[model samples]
Target chain A: MPQLVTVKVNRPDRRPVRVWVPVLPVALVLFPVVVLVVLAAIVACVVFRIGVVRALGAAWRVISALPGARFDIEQGRTAVLVAIR
Target chain B: MTEQRKDILDMLVAGKITAEEAEQLIAALERDQAPATGSLDARPKGKVKYLRVVVDATDNGEPSRVNVRVPLQLLRAGVRLAALVPPQALVKANASLSDSGVPIDLTQLKPEQLEALVEHLDEVTVEVDSPDATVRVFCE
Candidate 1:
Protein backbone atom coordinates (compact mmCIF):
# COMPACT_ATOMS: atom_id res chain seq x y z
CA MET A 1 0.00 0.00 0.00
CA PRO A 2 1.20 3.45 -0.80
CA GLN A 3 1.85 5.83 2.04
CA LEU A 4 2.49 8.93 -0.04
CA VAL A 5 1.36 10.69 -3.18
CA THR A 6 3.30 13.34 -5.11
CA VAL A 7 1.93 15.89 -7.52
CA LYS A 8 3.78 18.33 -9.77
CA VAL A 9 2.44 20.97 -12.09
CA ASN A 10 4.18 23.30 -14.51
CA ARG A 11 2.58 25.96 -16.68
CA PRO A 12 3.84 28.45 -19.20
CA ASP A 13 5.23 31.61 -17.52
CA ARG A 14 4.16 30.33 -14.10
CA ARG A 15 6.08 28.90 -11.13
CA PRO A 16 6.32 25.14 -11.12
CA VAL A 17 4.44 23.69 -8.18
CA ARG A 18 5.03 20.43 -6.34
CA VAL A 19 3.34 18.88 -3.36
CA TRP A 20 3.73 15.69 -1.34
CA VAL A 21 0.73 14.18 0.42
CA PRO A 22 1.10 11.64 3.19
CA VAL A 23 -1.72 9.11 3.06
CA LEU A 24 -1.11 7.21 6.26
CA PRO A 25 -2.14 9.97 8.60
CA VAL A 26 -5.26 10.69 6.61
CA ALA A 27 -6.17 7.04 6.44
CA LEU A 28 -5.67 6.68 10.19
CA VAL A 29 -7.89 9.65 10.88
CA LEU A 30 -10.63 8.20 8.74
CA PHE A 31 -10.28 4.62 9.94
CA PRO A 32 -12.85 4.81 12.69
CA VAL A 33 -15.33 6.63 10.49
CA VAL A 34 -14.82 4.11 7.73
CA VAL A 35 -15.42 1.26 10.14
CA LEU A 36 -18.65 2.80 11.30
CA VAL A 37 -19.83 3.41 7.78
CA VAL A 38 -18.94 -0.12 6.78
CA LEU A 39 -20.85 -1.58 9.65
CA ALA A 40 -23.86 0.46 8.74
CA ALA A 41 -23.54 -0.54 5.15
CA ILE A 42 -23.35 -4.19 6.11
CA VAL A 43 -26.52 -3.89 8.06
CA ALA A 44 -28.22 -2.15 5.19
CA CYS A 45 -27.02 -4.80 2.80
CA VAL A 46 -28.38 -7.53 5.02
CA VAL A 47 -31.73 -5.85 5.09
CA PHE A 48 -31.70 -5.31 1.34
CA ARG A 49 -30.52 -8.84 0.53
CA ILE A 50 -27.33 -7.58 -1.11
CA GLY A 51 -23.98 -9.36 -1.05
CA VAL A 52 -22.35 -7.61 1.86
CA VAL A 53 -19.23 -9.74 1.98
CA ARG A 54 -18.56 -9.33 -1.71
CA ALA A 55 -19.03 -5.58 -1.57
CA LEU A 56 -16.66 -5.28 1.36
CA GLY A 57 -14.10 -7.44 -0.38
CA ALA A 58 -14.33 -5.32 -3.49
CA ALA A 59 -13.92 -2.09 -1.55
CA TRP A 60 -10.82 -3.42 0.17
CA ARG A 61 -9.42 -4.56 -3.14
CA VAL A 62 -9.87 -1.10 -4.63
CA ILE A 63 -8.13 0.53 -1.69
CA SER A 64 -5.24 -1.89 -1.79
CA ALA A 65 -4.80 -1.35 -5.52
CA LEU A 66 -4.45 2.42 -5.42
CA PRO A 67 -0.68 2.42 -5.05
CA GLY A 68 1.86 2.47 -7.90
CA ALA A 69 -0.39 4.56 -10.09
CA ARG A 70 0.94 7.51 -12.05
CA PHE A 71 -0.34 9.97 -14.58
CA ASP A 72 1.65 12.52 -16.58
CA ILE A 73 0.46 14.91 -19.24
CA GLU A 74 2.50 17.44 -21.14
CA GLN A 75 1.31 19.92 -23.69
CA GLY A 76 3.64 22.45 -25.26
CA ARG A 77 5.24 24.13 -22.27
CA THR A 78 2.82 22.88 -19.62
CA ALA A 79 3.04 19.61 -17.73
CA VAL A 80 1.32 17.89 -14.88
CA LEU A 81 2.28 14.73 -13.04
CA VAL A 82 0.66 12.76 -10.25
CA ALA A 83 2.17 9.66 -8.73
CA ILE A 84 1.20 7.41 -5.87
CA ARG A 85 3.75 5.41 -3.94
CA MET B 1 7.65 -37.22 -22.74
CA THR B 2 7.08 -36.49 -19.10
CA GLU B 3 7.86 -39.03 -16.43
CA GLN B 4 4.17 -39.53 -15.87
CA ARG B 5 3.58 -40.23 -19.54
CA LYS B 6 6.57 -42.60 -19.62
CA ASP B 7 5.17 -44.43 -16.61
CA ILE B 8 1.83 -44.76 -18.29
CA LEU B 9 3.52 -46.15 -21.42
CA ASP B 10 5.51 -48.57 -19.33
CA MET B 11 2.36 -49.72 -17.65
CA LEU B 12 0.86 -50.38 -21.03
CA VAL B 13 3.97 -52.29 -22.20
CA ALA B 14 4.02 -54.39 -19.01
CA GLY B 15 0.36 -55.23 -19.53
CA LYS B 16 -0.45 -53.67 -16.19
CA ILE B 17 -2.95 -51.41 -17.98
CA THR B 18 -4.79 -51.66 -21.27
CA ALA B 19 -3.81 -49.45 -24.21
CA GLU B 20 -7.05 -47.55 -23.86
CA GLU B 21 -6.35 -47.02 -20.18
CA ALA B 22 -2.87 -45.73 -20.95
CA GLU B 23 -4.28 -43.34 -23.50
CA GLN B 24 -6.85 -42.11 -21.01
CA LEU B 25 -4.12 -41.62 -18.42
CA ILE B 26 -2.05 -39.57 -20.80
CA ALA B 27 -5.02 -37.49 -21.79
CA ALA B 28 -5.80 -36.85 -18.14
CA LEU B 29 -2.24 -35.88 -17.46
CA GLU B 30 -2.26 -33.41 -20.30
CA ARG B 31 -5.60 -32.03 -19.26
CA ASP B 32 -4.49 -31.57 -15.67
CA GLN B 33 -1.14 -30.05 -16.55
CA ALA B 34 -2.09 -27.83 -19.46
CA PRO B 35 -2.08 -24.65 -17.37
CA ALA B 36 1.07 -25.64 -15.54
CA THR B 37 3.23 -26.62 -18.52
CA GLY B 38 1.66 -25.93 -21.88
CA SER B 39 0.66 -22.39 -20.99
CA LEU B 40 4.00 -21.51 -19.45
CA ASP B 41 5.03 -19.77 -22.62
CA ALA B 42 1.88 -17.68 -22.58
CA ARG B 43 2.28 -16.69 -18.95
CA PRO B 44 4.33 -13.57 -18.17
CA LYS B 45 7.78 -14.22 -16.75
CA GLY B 46 7.03 -11.94 -13.82
CA LYS B 47 3.77 -10.87 -12.26
CA VAL B 48 2.43 -7.86 -14.08
CA LYS B 49 2.08 -5.03 -11.61
CA TYR B 50 0.97 -2.21 -13.86
CA LEU B 51 -0.70 -1.33 -17.14
CA ARG B 52 0.90 1.55 -19.00
CA VAL B 53 -0.35 3.79 -21.76
CA VAL B 54 1.73 6.36 -23.60
CA VAL B 55 0.79 8.80 -26.30
CA ASP B 56 2.91 11.29 -28.14
CA ALA B 57 1.25 13.62 -30.58
CA THR B 58 1.87 16.83 -32.46
CA ASP B 59 -1.21 18.97 -33.01
CA ASN B 60 -0.92 22.18 -35.01
CA GLY B 61 2.82 22.15 -34.39
CA GLU B 62 2.31 21.84 -30.63
CA PRO B 63 3.79 18.67 -29.22
CA SER B 64 1.80 16.88 -26.57
CA ARG B 65 2.46 13.72 -24.61
CA VAL B 66 0.53 11.61 -22.15
CA ASN B 67 1.78 8.76 -19.98
CA VAL B 68 -0.33 6.81 -17.55
CA ARG B 69 0.54 3.83 -15.42
CA VAL B 70 -2.28 2.10 -13.59
CA PRO B 71 -1.86 -0.66 -11.08
CA LEU B 72 -3.09 -3.93 -12.52
CA GLN B 73 -4.55 -4.79 -9.17
CA LEU B 74 -6.98 -1.91 -9.69
CA LEU B 75 -8.31 -3.66 -12.76
CA ARG B 76 -8.75 -6.83 -10.78
CA ALA B 77 -10.52 -4.86 -8.08
CA GLY B 78 -12.83 -3.22 -10.60
CA VAL B 79 -13.74 -6.61 -12.03
CA ARG B 80 -14.54 -7.86 -8.59
CA LEU B 81 -16.65 -4.80 -7.97
CA ALA B 82 -18.60 -5.55 -11.09
CA ALA B 83 -19.77 -8.75 -9.51
CA LEU B 84 -21.59 -6.78 -6.87
CA VAL B 85 -23.75 -4.76 -9.23
CA PRO B 86 -27.41 -5.58 -9.00
CA PRO B 87 -28.82 -7.79 -11.74
CA GLN B 88 -31.35 -5.16 -12.74
CA ALA B 89 -28.60 -2.56 -13.07
CA LEU B 90 -26.54 -4.94 -15.11
CA VAL B 91 -29.47 -5.57 -17.41
CA LYS B 92 -29.90 -1.86 -17.96
CA ALA B 93 -26.17 -1.42 -18.46
CA ASN B 94 -26.13 -4.28 -20.92
CA ALA B 95 -28.94 -2.74 -22.89
CA SER B 96 -27.21 0.65 -22.92
CA LEU B 97 -23.97 -0.95 -24.04
CA SER B 98 -25.77 -2.82 -26.78
CA ASP B 99 -27.43 0.35 -27.94
CA SER B 100 -23.96 1.94 -28.01
CA GLY B 101 -22.73 -0.94 -30.21
CA VAL B 102 -20.66 -2.62 -27.50
CA PRO B 103 -22.51 -5.96 -27.79
CA ILE B 104 -21.31 -7.07 -24.40
CA ASP B 105 -23.23 -8.72 -21.60
CA LEU B 106 -22.35 -7.62 -18.11
CA THR B 107 -24.36 -10.50 -16.76
CA GLN B 108 -22.02 -13.00 -18.30
CA LEU B 109 -18.84 -11.44 -16.89
CA LYS B 110 -17.66 -13.86 -14.27
CA PRO B 111 -14.82 -12.90 -11.95
CA GLU B 112 -12.97 -16.10 -12.75
CA GLN B 113 -13.09 -15.34 -16.46
CA LEU B 114 -11.85 -11.80 -15.85
CA GLU B 115 -9.04 -13.17 -13.70
CA ALA B 116 -7.93 -15.32 -16.62
CA LEU B 117 -8.21 -12.33 -18.92
CA VAL B 118 -6.08 -10.26 -16.56
CA GLU B 119 -3.44 -12.98 -16.45
CA HIS B 120 -3.27 -13.06 -20.24
CA LEU B 121 -3.26 -9.26 -20.51
CA ASP B 122 0.48 -9.18 -19.85
CA GLU B 123 1.03 -10.91 -23.18
CA VAL B 124 -0.83 -8.23 -25.09
CA THR B 125 0.74 -5.05 -26.39
CA VAL B 126 -0.95 -2.55 -28.63
CA GLU B 127 0.82 0.18 -30.57
CA VAL B 128 -0.46 2.71 -33.05
CA ASP B 129 1.55 5.14 -35.15
CA SER B 130 0.27 7.90 -37.37
CA PRO B 131 1.71 10.97 -39.04
CA ASP B 132 1.08 13.09 -35.95
CA ALA B 133 0.87 10.66 -33.09
CA THR B 134 2.18 7.46 -31.57
CA VAL B 135 0.31 5.48 -28.95
CA ARG B 136 1.43 2.45 -26.99
CA VAL B 137 -0.25 0.32 -24.40
CA PHE B 138 1.25 -2.59 -22.52
CA CYS B 139 1.47 -4.33 -19.17
CA GLU B 140 4.54 -4.43 -16.95
Candidate 2:
Protein backbone atom coordinates (compact mmCIF):
# COMPACT_ATOMS: atom_id res chain seq x y z
CA MET A 1 0.00 0.00 0.00
CA PRO A 2 1.19 3.54 -0.71
CA GLN A 3 2.01 5.63 2.28
CA LEU A 4 -0.78 8.17 2.88
CA VAL A 5 0.31 11.80 3.11
CA THR A 6 -1.72 14.41 5.01
CA VAL A 7 -1.87 18.01 3.84
CA LYS A 8 -2.84 21.01 5.95
CA VAL A 9 -4.23 24.22 4.53
CA ASN A 10 -5.18 27.37 6.40
CA ARG A 11 -7.56 29.79 4.71
CA PRO A 12 -8.26 33.36 5.76
CA ASP A 13 -11.99 33.15 5.04
CA ARG A 14 -12.62 29.53 5.92
CA ARG A 15 -11.73 27.10 8.64
CA PRO A 16 -8.31 25.42 8.49
CA VAL A 17 -8.58 22.19 6.53
CA ARG A 18 -6.53 19.14 5.64
CA VAL A 19 -6.17 16.62 2.81
CA TRP A 20 -4.53 13.22 2.35
CA VAL A 21 -2.99 11.31 -0.48
CA PRO A 22 -1.87 7.74 -0.75
CA VAL A 23 1.51 8.31 -2.32
CA LEU A 24 1.69 5.87 -5.23
CA PRO A 25 -0.08 3.49 -2.83
CA VAL A 26 3.44 2.71 -1.58
CA ALA A 27 4.65 5.74 0.35
CA LEU A 28 3.55 4.23 3.65
CA VAL A 29 4.01 7.47 5.56
CA LEU A 30 1.31 9.41 3.68
CA PHE A 31 -2.25 9.62 5.01
CA PRO A 32 -4.26 12.64 4.02
CA VAL A 33 -7.78 13.43 5.30
CA VAL A 34 -9.21 14.09 1.87
CA VAL A 35 -8.10 10.64 0.80
CA LEU A 36 -10.48 9.10 3.32
CA VAL A 37 -13.22 11.53 2.39
CA VAL A 38 -12.75 10.63 -1.27
CA LEU A 39 -12.65 7.01 -0.39
CA ALA A 40 -16.09 7.33 1.14
CA ALA A 41 -17.27 9.35 -1.82
CA ILE A 42 -15.94 6.70 -4.19
CA VAL A 43 -17.88 4.06 -2.31
CA ALA A 44 -20.95 6.19 -2.57
CA CYS A 45 -20.35 6.57 -6.27
CA VAL A 46 -19.96 2.84 -6.59
CA VAL A 47 -23.20 2.31 -4.74
CA PHE A 48 -24.76 4.60 -7.34
CA ARG A 49 -23.53 2.31 -10.15
CA ILE A 50 -20.24 4.07 -10.80
CA GLY A 51 -17.02 2.12 -11.46
CA VAL A 52 -15.03 1.70 -8.25
CA VAL A 53 -11.62 1.19 -9.88
CA ARG A 54 -12.19 4.12 -12.20
CA ALA A 55 -13.19 6.35 -9.33
CA LEU A 56 -10.23 5.24 -7.21
CA GLY A 57 -7.87 5.73 -10.10
CA ALA A 58 -9.24 9.21 -10.70
CA ALA A 59 -8.78 10.07 -7.04
CA TRP A 60 -5.16 8.95 -7.20
CA ARG A 61 -4.61 11.17 -10.15
CA VAL A 62 -5.92 14.15 -8.19
CA ILE A 63 -3.64 13.50 -5.24
CA SER A 64 -0.71 13.32 -7.60
CA ALA A 65 -1.45 16.72 -9.07
CA LEU A 66 -1.18 18.76 -5.85
CA PRO A 67 1.65 21.24 -5.44
CA GLY A 68 4.31 21.04 -2.75
CA ALA A 69 1.83 20.97 0.14
CA ARG A 70 2.60 19.67 3.65
CA PHE A 71 1.56 16.14 4.42
CA ASP A 72 1.21 13.71 7.35
CA ILE A 73 1.18 9.97 7.00
CA GLU A 74 0.91 7.57 9.98
CA GLN A 75 -2.15 9.04 11.66
CA GLY A 76 -3.98 9.43 8.38
CA ARG A 77 -3.54 5.78 7.56
CA THR A 78 -5.12 4.69 10.87
CA ALA A 79 -8.02 7.05 10.34
CA VAL A 80 -8.51 5.81 6.80
CA LEU A 81 -8.39 2.18 7.88
CA VAL A 82 -10.90 2.81 10.62
CA ALA A 83 -13.16 4.62 8.20
CA ILE A 84 -12.93 1.73 5.80
CA ARG A 85 -13.89 -0.84 8.44
CA MET B 1 -59.49 63.59 14.24
CA THR B 2 -58.32 63.58 10.60
CA GLU B 3 -56.40 60.56 9.28
CA GLN B 4 -53.24 62.59 8.66
CA ARG B 5 -53.47 64.11 12.09
CA LYS B 6 -53.94 60.66 13.58
CA ASP B 7 -50.76 59.44 11.89
CA ILE B 8 -48.78 62.39 13.18
CA LEU B 9 -50.26 61.80 16.63
CA ASP B 10 -49.22 58.15 16.41
CA MET B 11 -45.70 59.16 15.43
CA LEU B 12 -45.56 61.72 18.21
CA VAL B 13 -46.74 59.20 20.80
CA ALA B 14 -44.15 56.72 19.58
CA GLY B 15 -41.52 59.49 19.91
CA LYS B 16 -40.74 59.34 16.20
CA ILE B 17 -41.99 62.72 15.18
CA THR B 18 -41.05 65.51 17.58
CA ALA B 19 -43.82 67.39 19.47
CA GLU B 20 -43.22 70.59 17.51
CA GLU B 21 -43.27 68.66 14.27
CA ALA B 22 -46.50 66.96 15.28
CA GLU B 23 -48.04 70.37 16.04
CA GLN B 24 -46.85 71.69 12.72
CA LEU B 25 -48.25 68.57 11.03
CA ILE B 26 -51.59 69.02 12.76
CA ALA B 27 -51.66 72.68 11.71
CA ALA B 28 -50.81 71.56 8.16
CA LEU B 29 -53.63 69.01 8.37
CA GLU B 30 -56.06 71.70 9.61
CA ARG B 31 -55.26 73.56 6.42
CA ASP B 32 -56.52 70.47 4.46
CA GLN B 33 -53.08 69.79 2.97
CA ALA B 34 -50.93 66.68 3.46
CA PRO B 35 -47.49 67.08 4.98
CA ALA B 36 -44.45 65.28 3.64
CA THR B 37 -42.31 63.84 6.42
CA GLY B 38 -39.42 63.23 3.96
CA SER B 39 -38.18 60.44 6.22
CA LEU B 40 -37.88 57.87 3.46
CA ASP B 41 -34.78 59.41 1.90
CA ALA B 42 -33.14 60.04 5.27
CA ARG B 43 -31.86 56.48 5.36
CA PRO B 44 -28.13 56.05 5.82
CA LYS B 45 -26.20 55.32 2.65
CA GLY B 46 -22.85 53.69 1.74
CA LYS B 47 -23.47 50.01 2.11
CA VAL B 48 -20.49 47.64 2.27
CA LYS B 49 -18.80 47.52 -1.12
CA TYR B 50 -16.48 44.57 -0.90
CA LEU B 51 -14.81 42.05 1.35
CA ARG B 52 -11.34 43.54 1.22
CA VAL B 53 -8.04 41.93 2.04
CA VAL B 54 -5.19 44.38 1.97
CA VAL B 55 -1.69 43.03 2.31
CA ASP B 56 1.23 45.38 2.73
CA ALA B 57 4.64 43.80 2.86
CA THR B 58 8.26 44.32 1.96
CA ASP B 59 9.35 41.37 -0.08
CA ASN B 60 13.10 41.32 -0.86
CA GLY B 61 13.45 45.00 0.17
CA GLU B 62 10.75 46.18 -2.18
CA PRO B 63 7.47 47.43 -0.74
CA SER B 64 4.53 45.63 -2.26
CA ARG B 65 0.80 45.77 -1.65
CA VAL B 66 -1.90 43.26 -2.41
CA ASN B 67 -5.52 44.28 -2.42
CA VAL B 68 -7.96 41.45 -2.72
CA ARG B 69 -11.54 42.40 -3.41
CA VAL B 70 -13.43 39.18 -2.95
CA PRO B 71 -17.04 39.76 -3.78
CA LEU B 72 -19.50 38.15 -1.40
CA GLN B 73 -21.13 36.43 -4.37
CA LEU B 74 -17.86 34.85 -5.52
CA LEU B 75 -17.64 32.89 -2.36
CA ARG B 76 -21.15 31.63 -3.00
CA ALA B 77 -20.36 30.73 -6.58
CA GLY B 78 -17.13 29.00 -5.64
CA VAL B 79 -18.81 26.80 -3.09
CA ARG B 80 -21.58 25.96 -5.56
CA LEU B 81 -19.03 25.11 -8.19
CA ALA B 82 -17.22 22.74 -5.84
CA ALA B 83 -20.26 20.52 -5.70
CA LEU B 84 -20.19 20.14 -9.41
CA VAL B 85 -16.61 18.86 -9.23
CA PRO B 86 -16.29 15.13 -9.08
CA PRO B 87 -14.85 13.68 -5.89
CA GLN B 88 -11.93 12.33 -7.87
CA ALA B 89 -10.97 15.79 -8.99
CA LEU B 90 -11.15 17.03 -5.44
CA VAL B 91 -8.97 14.18 -4.31
CA LYS B 92 -6.41 15.10 -6.93
CA ALA B 93 -6.50 18.76 -5.92
CA ASN B 94 -6.18 17.75 -2.30
CA ALA B 95 -3.05 15.78 -2.99
CA SER B 96 -1.60 18.58 -5.05
CA LEU B 97 -2.28 21.21 -2.41
CA SER B 98 -0.95 19.08 0.42
CA ASP B 99 2.31 18.66 -1.39
CA SER B 100 2.32 22.41 -1.79
CA GLY B 101 2.09 22.92 2.02
CA VAL B 102 -1.63 23.64 2.11
CA PRO B 103 -3.40 21.13 4.30
CA ILE B 104 -7.00 21.76 3.40
CA ASP B 105 -9.82 19.36 2.76
CA LEU B 106 -11.40 20.33 -0.54
CA THR B 107 -14.15 17.74 -0.23
CA GLN B 108 -15.81 19.53 2.67
CA LEU B 109 -16.79 22.68 0.82
CA LYS B 110 -20.55 23.24 0.74
CA PRO B 111 -22.63 26.38 0.29
CA GLU B 112 -24.77 25.74 3.37
CA GLN B 113 -21.71 24.95 5.45
CA LEU B 114 -20.26 28.39 4.71
CA GLU B 115 -23.38 30.36 5.75
CA ALA B 116 -22.45 30.71 9.42
CA LEU B 117 -18.78 31.20 8.66
CA VAL B 118 -19.53 34.09 6.32
CA GLU B 119 -22.19 35.54 8.61
CA HIS B 120 -19.78 36.06 11.49
CA LEU B 121 -17.28 37.57 9.07
CA ASP B 122 -19.58 40.15 7.52
CA GLU B 123 -18.60 43.69 8.47
CA VAL B 124 -15.82 42.37 10.66
CA THR B 125 -12.28 43.65 10.25
CA VAL B 126 -9.20 41.61 10.95
CA GLU B 127 -5.80 43.24 11.11
CA VAL B 128 -2.39 41.67 11.47
CA ASP B 129 0.75 43.72 11.53
CA SER B 130 4.30 42.55 11.69
CA PRO B 131 7.63 44.34 11.35
CA ASP B 132 7.48 43.85 7.60
CA ALA B 133 3.84 43.37 6.77
CA THR B 134 0.35 44.50 7.58
CA VAL B 135 -2.76 42.60 6.61
CA ARG B 136 -6.25 43.96 6.89
CA VAL B 137 -9.55 42.27 6.14
CA PHE B 138 -12.89 44.07 6.18
CA CYS B 139 -16.22 44.50 4.45
CA GLU B 140 -15.67 47.85 2.83
Tens digit per residue, CA lDDT, model 1, B5-92: 9999999999999989989999999899988876867754987789999999997799999999999889989888877777878899
lDDT of 2 by residue, A31-81 (tens): 576578777887787666566665565555444333222222222112111
Best model number under DockQ: 1
Candidate 1 predicts chain B with a TM-score of: 0.63
Docking class of 1: medium
State the lDDT of candidate 2 residue by residue for B1-140, as single tens digits: 66777889899999998999989888867666423444455656546534667777777776666555655544444444444466777899999999999989888876577755665566488999999988988875
| RMSD for each of the candidates | 7.5, 17.2
Model 1 lDDT, full chain set: 0.90
Worst 10 residues of 1 chain B by lDDT: B35-44
| CAPRI class of candidate 2 | incorrect
lDDT by residue for model 1 (A1-85), tens: 7789999999999999999989989878999997899999898778756788878888889878989999999999999999998
